[model samples]
Target chain A: MQKNKLIAGVSAGGLALLSSPAFAQSIDETVNHLFASATGWFVNFIFSPFPGTSFPWIVAWLVVAATVFTFYFTFIQFRAFKHSISLVKGDYSDPNDAGEVSHFQALATALSGTVGLGNIAGVAVAVGIGGPGATFWMILAGLMGMASKFTECTLGVKYRNEYADGTVSGGPMYYLTKGFAERGLPGGRFLAILFSIFCILGALGGGNMFQANQAHQQISGILGDFPGWITGVVFALVVFAVIVGGLKSIAKVTEKVVPFMGVMYVGAAIIILLVNADQIGWAFGQIFAGAFTGLGVAGGMVGALIQGFKRAAFSNEAGVGSAAIAHSAVRTKEPITEGFVSLLEPFIDTVVICTMTALVIIITGQLSIDPATGNYLTEGGRIVTVTGASGVGLTSAAFESAFSWFPYVLAIAVILFAFSTMISWSYYGLKAWTYLFGEGKTTEVVFKVIFCIFVVIGAAANLGPVIDFSDAAIFAMAVVNITGLYCLMPIVKRELTSYLARLESGEIKKFK
Target chain B: MATKYIVACDGSSASGRAIKVAVEQAKLNGASLLLVHVLEWSPYSFLTPEELEERHKRRNEELKRAQLALVDPLVESLSSEGVESSAIIRYGHVSETIADIAEKEGAAQIFVGRTGQSTLTKLIFGSVAASLAQIAPVPCTIVP
Candidate 1:
């Protein structure tokens, strides 16, 4: 259904561009118009601030959800941290178990979904606009967000549809509908449908377009300027090959390559931090002070808090419920185990990796600050002052200050990050698509083709609308998911209570 | 008393030779044959969520295929030779699972074909025969 809306918008742009004699000159405008107009109302609605405040209600929605879940579960993210690690280590796993995937595999699959441009580009945006203090808020939100993951993922597994054929299907759609009906609650099906719609949009906007747009931005930083559509078309074809052509071996190769790239990216960040070891203390100081006082950055402490929480939610996706889809596939009788495993995602993506990126930007002196006023030099492009370098470009500049060839390496990483993210999101969106439209080859192909088209459109469209819609769609998911979670969280808490009791009584023994 | 002999099959000619040898031993001793086939699998693997979702289905399919192609024919042939036989198919590390089955079944001895893997392959991945020799509870014979 959403695909039809997208097709109408795209064909409108196609018609406009085809009618124009200068196709190259008008393509950007037309694509931007189509994307912005189609998604603008939804974006404005999702991000519309609470009352008169500058803070987007969507950001507050996620923040409040995470905070509440943290308390409601009595800080399960912290309590289960050690146990979660053990579960991931396979301590309780039996060799003769009939499960399909290990806890580690489930966590890794979900991590690859969450940790992408949000760590690199999104961090740079946070620090560039919100100052170093955003780093502190980002970490705080990441920690709290872990609880949200625990609740949602637990419900995801408990309510998932396990078929006799040994395949399982789950996510917000399944849990919201099934759990609601089981509880005799109204609107479960409605909310489930609504969540699926937002999920599909989120998958396309944040998962597909935002990634392609950023990948193009980084590639263009080194490769000189060209029409983004060319890059978009190339990306779309490669993605089409994997998702539609049934070349799962390519997906397998990417599954291997992406983790290696993630490690290399983190290794580079660590090396940069070590080299700038002396400034680490000062950078932390900036982060702490800016978090409270805003360090004369725009919008003061409130701006920092908003950007920190917003980007953290976007980065880790703790409350948005997408990770629950991936986590539900684990081979475990205890639904709580996957929940425990999932809490590590926000910590890794936000607290650890996002902080590394923020520290690099701050330590590498990317944000131009005036010594006398102790304010960001906002006169002439002070934030990310390396002349038009923002997002991945800003991150690339920071890393390049440490290594001359880093940009070249970064371009490769960004593209791989983008491609892998696109592939993962395709599956996510397909799940949502199948939920709404019913699962069939044709329905599946229809969604896949629309997803590929958006890849091109995302790459070609301007960043402003693409990011706005991406943030909106993702947050929209949080609204429905968290509302459903509030009703169903007690169920998760019961499961956790029972599981822990069993563990303490030695009813559940560790095999290793 | 009737005894038991275990033969590991991979459908290769080497395994066919091992089956023949195990059959001869089983018939001479009035023993039954237990034909085992272990499909190599590890809990540790990097998979996409979609692949993970379908993994159980694929595992079932592979198990069924191995049962049909590797174990059933051998079980029928052993029966025709006047040796009682049964088959078990599983998924795990080949040598380890074979050793485990041997221990569990209390077999007198075990038989496996010498794999045609290259020296470097054997060095890198470890030969199944070499692993069985180290881990099997009973005496193990490798049919070349």
Candidate 2:
């Protein structure tokens, strides 16, 4: 009888909270106004100076770094591609090592952090703006970005601090401060502090807000118009439960979630592509033709190249320090193995997954073209995705072309993707927060609460400012991270050279 | 001692209980304790090449951790109790590995705990308790 009463009281409490007015329309508007305007300055400075070119130069450095790393590492992305796959498979993992997760789990976790809305909404946006030719550039960027990932993740592991509790603290902060100090380079401390600050903002913006915003957009598309704050509240509670305990529990959930969702998304894209298999040859032709001629797009080759490279940079996040943190926790004695394992992150996220999304959009006849200009017709506010408007809705329309009910599934998938990414970023942000302010329960709770609040704001607000600020924050992380990568690449090359030589000589035994 | 006993442990409360019962059995019957913790793993779970590669590394780490977290303390206590004891940590199917170790060590008896796995879990993924009854080479004790 008492147990029955306890259940009844809990149900009642839940109903009340669900219907609470405080979690409705009013809160959503307030949140939107607060964040969009506050981050205006950061959006400006990062994108400053056309310098005789119309290009937004902030992304140039990242692309340049990737290109340089690719050459400097002797196209390690190509040569070590098989080795990277093997490392991720745990081919050389030493079970006697200390760490919380396996190679695959670390890769999966980092992938989850990156492989969210970008694959769906971001792809649609890129294709809409850059045209079909963008797909070629995106693939190129993903390919080169593999080297950039190798450079940073190697340092992330090589310089990680293993505490007495057997837990690890790593990323640009550790590598910059310790690695530079060892190399007799100055400014490692300043760079680490700068990277940590950007990482925290990025965790809140790109990781939390951008995900929440896109999820809300998809939810609103399916469920019809509703208060963003309500969606925010539900998302916050779920994210808080996963993230409050930090990496261990978060890793468990993301490892499973990322792989399943990734396969599902890729599988769905493949199935859709197969259904339109007759158009397969024509689609590749359009991509290649569009690459050189730009067909009839306004900006021609330059526009497509910029958009493709930009989206690819955003998608894989090669030089960003966040994945380094996630990868550092894998149970492996050799730091270089984790580096090899991490480069696969971009190849999977962009080259494989994003390409599938692109093919589906093109093959399904969702992207409408302008006959006169030979460019994709843009009306309404959305361009990148199928139908009008960019984001998950556009991706949904492409899938809806194949299966009518897929929009609902896509909505749920988007939410799951967004949720997983948010939690992973929460860890990234939390680590940065802890690094800045010494570790303690009080500091953790404070950061977590702030992060949860942002989820709701992200859902309620206009996508433009939230995405703008997040893109800027994410790129800011790249700026600081790549700077550190530049100083540390020689060491990474030495480690790679030694590991590969030893591997070839049979000194580094493969356990399996 | 003429007799040897095998105890399957996982550092849980129930596993601690299994250890306690095994210690008493060792004291009463003049048997030695061989505490074992098996991290149940199957190569089939690693369907992809990536998972296969990490299998050995994962196995080594699991064994090392199990030895440190489960076997070491249990062995120390048993020895301090005037009961001769040793430990083994391994990665494989828990029931099969436990039984294999028991057979190889020539243990006269085996002990294990009723773990947190529910009735449905045991139904689908057969419990260590049920498997022991069918495959164990010696008499088995399921400590509650």
Candidate 3:
């Protein structure tokens, strides 16, 4: 009887395995179809172009808000640039202050969140599509983004709630609700709720899923083609450990290691540039020429500008109000100091780092620009990706051309970047979750489990419409955040003026 | 004017000897003893935003616990022995902070327990006694 049972179990297992492939394929198709249809309306509405134009209204919304803040603050990004450096260096920090974080710690954590795929893959996408000129617009947008970061972060700290248990919470949600009410403005609560909802969606899609998706792609590129679900399950388990198990040491280790990888990445870029030293001037020339003439890039200069601003906004996230959540945790009596520290984020992320990625791609001949036509080589009316690979893969190809061993390094960096991003976004999403549902152990755990599950789904499925919807959700945050920022600008100006006046009078003591 | 002496405590047997020597010296010289316990910390160490958020609260808790467990009882025992004493707790590089307190307090001399760190540790991260001997503004005494 036992021998008969064993034989029967083995036969059943074999039979199920033989049939499972077709069943699995059908399931995958059904899920993909459902996601595409469900998310189509949101993606269309958010990314819909302006009247008779291809420019996305969401991109325009972010750019306009950044530009307005730059003017409203009297170019505070430039004016307080020196002060921002001082604050980050801890020269003005009071060790006895009630806050938890130093300016540098806050900036570094926020940078880890914003600096991931956007700097690596997103820049590749921009330059690949918009030509070399997108670099120029990207740098410009990054600079203007400083002011927007400064305003939102200042408001974040000013409106943060401190509890008797020695814990605190702050972000765009706090500012929108409390700040609006303080100014006697109606609809602050509604706006806050809307912002929180979008923030959660953005966190799931772009932060968790997109990160897992890209990481799996990079790993499979190296380790040989296997199912994405395998990668997804592994990533999900590790992420679950860090976020749910409270494995803070692992999180801290990643935080330290990610910055080191960032440095190595930049160093490699510098070496590649130096290796092709003679082409440095020509690369800049291409950037400048492409910015205006579009270098035969489709949709001309306007296309370049749109891609540049969109990628930079996506990369630095200056106006999205996410950085405000990170910066609000800083320990300081003066809220304006965090704002100063935050402006450096865009400058470093987009102007410095993203520019490096663009130059490497342009200089290494990955773009394959045709000198005769003054246009990048194209197939089927669209600029072709190297080896039919786009995004981080294209970036890897560019680096591989310089160093044969670089793909392995690139793969490691990509995984590290993806992991760091997921952890940071987990925190951001958790904050949004608690804001909406009210802080509770069970409620928090529910959000985390859902976030981890999405990581697996994000890795397994190729959900184009879903990813688009997620991107739109991130920008939707900018819409609600920037509106609150407009009403709250005067408040930021008041804080900045007072802080600067005190600094000039030597009233703010220098600790070092 | 009464002189002042500094004692570094680590709640070790070596530190007990150091404390006894300092108390004796304080009585003889009519000096007040400032017992200092320094917790090792590096400002350059990076932390996550969540960790950073809880840092100040954690630091305060650590300081409170150190004062109650290490510094206060020692100070009370010294006073009972008719030795004038006070206590301080701080976070930073161990030797450097103790030396800093010595300089700022205008003490004539400093006393410390020879650290019990192993040879490998001492070679890697030098013992506090060795560091204090080199950098202290006042003469440093390391009691075994």
Name model 2 segments beyond 4 Å from true: A1-34, A95-100, A244-255, A371-374, A379-386, B1-34, B40-85, B91-123, B127-144
Docking class of 1: medium
Better of 2 and 3 by lDDT: 3
All models, RMSD in angstroms = 2.8, 8.1, 5.1
Report per-candidate DockQ: 0.54, 0.08, 0.51
List the candidate numbers ranked by DockQ, top first. 1, 3, 2
Model 1: DockQ against the native?
A: 0.54
Please provide TM-scores, in order, for all candidate models, with all chains considered together: 0.93, 0.82, 0.94
* TM-score between model 2 and native: 0.82
Residue-wise C-alpha lDDT for candidate 1, range A273-324, written one tens digit per residue: 9988999999999999999998877788998898899899999999898998
Name the runs in model 1 displaced over 4 angstroms.
A1-23, A379-382, A386-388, B1-6, B23-33, B82-85, B100-110, B133-140
lDDT of candidate 3 at residue A127, scale 0 to 100? 88
- State the lDDT of candidate 3 residue by residue for A1-512, as single tens digits: 53354345434534654788544433334444555666678878888999899988988898899999999999999999998998888788764441246688888889999888889988988888788899999999999999999999999999988776677788999999999999999999999999999899889888888788788879989999676666877999999999899988788788889999999999999999999999999999999999998887788898888889988988898889899988887768899999999999999999999999999988887876677986877665346755666778889899999999998998999898989989888888999999999999999999999898778767766735545766887888898999999999999999988998999899998987
| Index of the highest-lDDT prediction | 1
